[model samples]
Target: MHKYFTIFKDSYYGYFNYLWSEITTFHWENYFYGLIVVSLLVWGLEILFPWRKNQKIFRKDFWLDTFYMFFNFFLLNLIVLIFLSNATAQLFNDFLGLINLQLSDFQIVNLNALPYGLGLLVFFLVTDFVQWNTHILLHRVPFLWNFHKLHHSVTEMGFAAHLRYHWMEPIVYKSILYIPLAIIGGFDVEAVAIVHFSALTIGHLNHANLGWDYGILKYIFNNPKMHIWHHVKELPENTEYGINYGISLSVWDYIFNTHHVPYDGRDIELGFEDDHEFPLEFTDQIIYPVKKKRSKSA
Candidate 1:
């Protein structure tokens, strides 16, 4: 009991201190500043070369999405997730000790010993592949899709919309990614940070109002032109879940036969078919999925 209490208290203070450092630090790895830099850069691109010319600079639900970004990134994680995750992890570790099992046993190879460039490439590719599969589950799983709908509610996409998602989402992604990353062993922190920032930049651009395919690279990388099709309201024929489930890479979609971009999606209607009745208020949106599931089960 005392251990759980200490974990909760420590996480509360530790998370705030971490946030303060991330904001005060001037170094390249500061995620707070990195988010600001990437967001502004993408917003500039949207301003200079917007594909949706009629959409206003401050598009619909802009402030809402901005709040969702910060809330999901900082506040929600601190207020609820950190304490719970820390406690759960501690409990899991304790249970493993009882069984004389160790997580280290699952590791396969030491990635840090590899050449820097090669290790980074391998790390990026492996992580992105995990992300792509996780993204498909979010779309195909009925229970998970209830939470993921918050992201697709965007009527006018922008850079900030990239971060707008339900609070449970990071849990889903991180929980699934943990084992795969651990198995690779000794991934350099710097390499992971660089890949994270690169992916962040690409994600912002993917949701930006700029229509860019990266030409031939579109086959390898996901771009705004390809991602817009993912948010199209109507389900394409013969497919039920969704298409274009790629994250930072489009190669997986191509390999899995989930890729589909029949034409320019610049003018396509975004959001799910019944999004008209989706809650616009944050509290309502957050509670909606829970209430809906409970009602159905009853």
Candidate 2:
């Protein structure tokens, strides 16, 4: 128990220092700076292209979403995620030890044997496929959707809205992703950072006002045009969870037959049926999922 507690404490300080260094240093691999660059560049595109002509540059809840970006990205890690992830991984390792099992036993492909470039590609694809499945679980599972509802609360989408999800989301996504990625790809820090930045940029583009579908690659990667339908207030008839659950790749949705876009769908309303009554304040939204009145709206 003391060891786990120490692990948590060390993770908190370690992650804080790492984030501080990312902010202070000018490095090619800085995740913090990568966030700012992706945000501004995509916002510039929104300003230039003007997808929804009537939507202002600072659309509704713009600042709110901006705060969410910082909170979910930096502050959340500073407070909880870093320690939780570190501690959980430690505990899981202990459990695996009791059973005399190890990550090596589960390794299907040794990334070290492959060319480093192909190793990176394999890492990105495998993790992304995991996230895509996790995204579907977020919608299909009722309790999970309550937390996910805050993201769906975006009536007017923009680049910043990409990260406006519940803090519980990262815990859920990362928890589901941790083991599979570890088993398949090993812990290639360089590969992880590259995939993260790539997904972050694609996520911004997917939620931005632009309507790009990546031309012929629409079948491969996710873009704003296809992702917009994912926000529609109502899923198409007979749909259970939702459609277009892809995070960084559209191929999953297409292959799973969950893709739906009968029309342009640019002007469609966003959010669940009761979105008007949903909590808007950040604090309220954080607690909204766990409060007594969740199951009704879900």
Q: Rate the local accuracy (lDDT) of all candidates.
A: 0.89, 0.89
Candidate 2 global lDDT: 0.89
Candidate 2: residue 226 Cα off by (Å): 0.4
What lDDT score goes with residue 260 in model 1? Answer: 93
Give the C-alpha miss distance for residue 268 in model 1, angstroms: 0.4
Model 2 residue 60 lDDT score: 97
* Candidate 1 error regions (>4 Å): none
Model 1, 58-139: lDDT tens digits are 9998889888878887898788889977776687678878999776777787788888888888899999999999999999
Error of 2 at 201 (Å): 0.7
Ten contiguous residues minimizing lDDT sum, candidate 1: 84-93
* Model 2 root-mean-square deviation: 1.8
lDDT of 2 by residue, 160-274 (tens): 9999999999999999988886677575677778888999999999999997888899999998999999999988898868899888999988998989878887789988878
